[model samples]
Target: MNLKARITRTGAILLGKYVACDGFDEQQPIRVVTHVHADHMLGLRESLKKCEMVLMSEATRDLIDVLKSPLFLMAGNVKTLPYKEPFEYKNEKITFYPADHILGSTQVLVEDQEGERILYTSDFRLPNTPIIRSDILVIEATYGSPRCIRNFEQKAESVLVDLVDRGLCEGPVYLFGYHGKIQEVMEILWKNNIRVPFIVPEKVFHVCKVYEKHNKKLGRYWLARSEYAKELRSKKEPFVAFYHMAARRRFIKEKAYKIFVSGWQFQEPIRQVNEKGFVIAISDHSDFEGLIEYVRKSKPKLVLTDNYRIGHAKILAKEIEKRLGIRAIAVPPTKPKKK
Candidate 1:
């Protein structure tokens, strides 16, 4: 059950004989895509060319279908892995658990025939579902800094509701956020019975459909298109639009009030407002306290930090070692050697 970890531009690759890839890439024989985030799917297309098979959650496959991106490999190349079910691969058992990051995100658990367990948490948040014992734990440290810690979930609902209420009074309100955060905001609005036509970008519209397919209705939403934009411009009524951060500026000509939602708002020079709009503190990844708590509860014999926010990983590893007495180390990426 000897395992070695290798980091690539896409993500971490664990190798032995039956390789377990944590993210999208064809560098290994067996590739496991934890989620559909762009960073995790860097070499997805190229990997499909070299790898035997790529494993991912059914939800991820559905997401890829909706995106219709040429970057993704063919459907035949992907093998859907059901959550929490153990599947035999080569001489090892692999299980997928809900990662709580996005709609089909998973935390992979690989167990070798020799009873050695390895857990690779690609990206996760609070209220994780995986509760298994592991010999080695590879965890993400996206927000592994003391300054990043904040109880956002408990406060996000109220803050967003207030913002929406105020924005509706002005003109078309543009809410800028990522896929998962936008969905959460929509759900909050729905549960509060704030019935309003929400204009979403094309990608978000497709993602919402997948959520509905899973029976998670996000209320009334229309895709933002040329026709819809013209119609909105003609109308004199105020509306709400949820858009991806990249496309937020597109609606500026329509006099839409913009608001950027992200956890990074907490840091920096306290920029409450910009030329475009205001910034709000909302995040998906676990904060510093949550990261420490996870390590304490996992109780793994050895801990390996994710390459994301490597500086935070180094600091977090030291804290884990000092606080929990666990053998923690920030795994540095292998540097290329000069020929």
Candidate 2:
């Protein structure tokens, strides 16, 4: 059984013949999503234009639908498949397992009819995060360097609180994070007694519902739209508005205190937001050690680097082979430009 994977920055991988990891590559057919972060879903529009089928969890489909815009307009045809339901494509049976990276996030398992299985861990966190539990272990090591191997959840939360308490601004706390970490942060705020009427954009509101569907609690608030005027007017205290990065610009005009969240906060976008808004490096991707450990367990005959840290992937692939005698190969080619 021969397994091949082509990793793309949009988190789309050409797996075997007909299946794709994420994104809308004109070259592939079916696309499977492990998570809905922008990088993963960036190329989806083009994918739907060329492919016939797109597979994702029911909750993820709903969230994608909620995020209707020019980017996701072509996603109308996405078919919702329940987690663990093995489906046939290109004569291969593929299954999705929960990865606990964020809401509706999953780790993909592709198996041939002859029972050869290949697992793709697209931006995953092992042992789970605050809101979700890690099950099948295909993990992402965006932070998979030795320097990021410590538990920073408590410290991260305190940083947010400290910013608010330090009188950065006496206004609505606008925290910018993706759908993956929003609910977890909200739960943390609730647990820490951060009393505020949290506001979330409609898109993220739908995304948060999925977390609630899995029994994870978001905070005690709603959207800031006029429809929720009663709730908005009755707000007794300031609240956190968990939103997508795009929504940050508008919130800034509302005179609300702003915050940016992510594991990649040290990078350009998040860092830019930090200079203008309160920022924290609460990451969902596994650190370097986590990535090495998880990949070692799978024992694949070859490994593919999923486009973020190519140098790291190449180095780690060699280390895996040397340490375990299992051959690991990095998927070649850089990111495809948007057409």
Candidate 3:
């Protein structure tokens, strides 16, 4: 089969693949942002210049502006599309749905005239998360491994409660994660009636403010650089604070207890910290079961995945075809191999 025949036969395209274009080059990019996590967006700068147009959610655009500095050059080549709106680009009609991963993450769906559709489910979480909507039928799998199943939230919460009970009743509780994850932690605390004065990095706090503007109540916390420092210092009740890795040690003093959250914690320096303090697996990515359910619902003809989870995606595809009798196969990641 010719290249066009192959692409036409299977309605799918990997990250660095071409559809009605030459080989997918970072310089020849099309509108693509599979959630706002750093890993998913590593090469976006190079990719942006390649494509004729760029499309993503408004919130994502705002967050990217904050994340990227001297944002003038990087911010110019994009257009913000509303959620689920059908837009035409590269002669194809496409729609974007909420990925439920982060505040402004999205899953891209492209529909052609022949009724063939391809959905790229950026990293997403099926369970209830703060400030994001869960899509019943998503596409692709970023977390399709059996090891993905975990009870990090429940386990971490129990440990946190115990640690809080043992604390001096007024010491600060330092919790660490990315900006978006920190907001999620704060939301969980609020829902469980674990109210406390919390701290987050200034950048994360800015995003939280955006969430609050949209009326998603997170927590009654102050930015570390914000006013009311005296009030936070004088706090006598339980408190929660979020910081980046660089700021972890300084904020987490001998008196203050520390907690780390993320799937990454199941490994590395995080595991080291878990020995003493606490680590939670509250992730924004889907688990194995969630990934399968999403694939079955979407019913795409072919599958594509990132390198780390490519095998997991392929395994899930096999199970899906066996159970539902659907034709599905896993495709390579955008990059042939990691550098």
Highest-lDDT candidate: 1
Q: What TM value does model 3 have?
A: 0.77
Clashes of each: 1, 6, 2
Q: Is candidate 1 or candidate 3 better by TM-score?
A: 1
- Cα lDDT of candidate 3 equals 0.57
Assess each prediction's global lDDT (C-alpha) against the native: 0.72, 0.64, 0.57
Please give, for residues 28-112, the per-residue lDDT of candidate 2 as tens digits.
6787765667667756766676678878887777666666653574544678777777888767877777776777877777775
lDDT of model 3, residue 87: 79
lDDT of 1 by residue, 112-190 (tens): 7777778877777786645456788888777766766775557766777777777787767888888777887788788
Positional deviation of residue 284's Cα in model 1 after best superposition, in angstroms:
1.3
- Best candidate according to TM-score: 1
Model 1 pairs in collision: 26-47
Q: What TM-score number comes out for model 2?
A: 0.77
lDDT of 3 at 324: 59
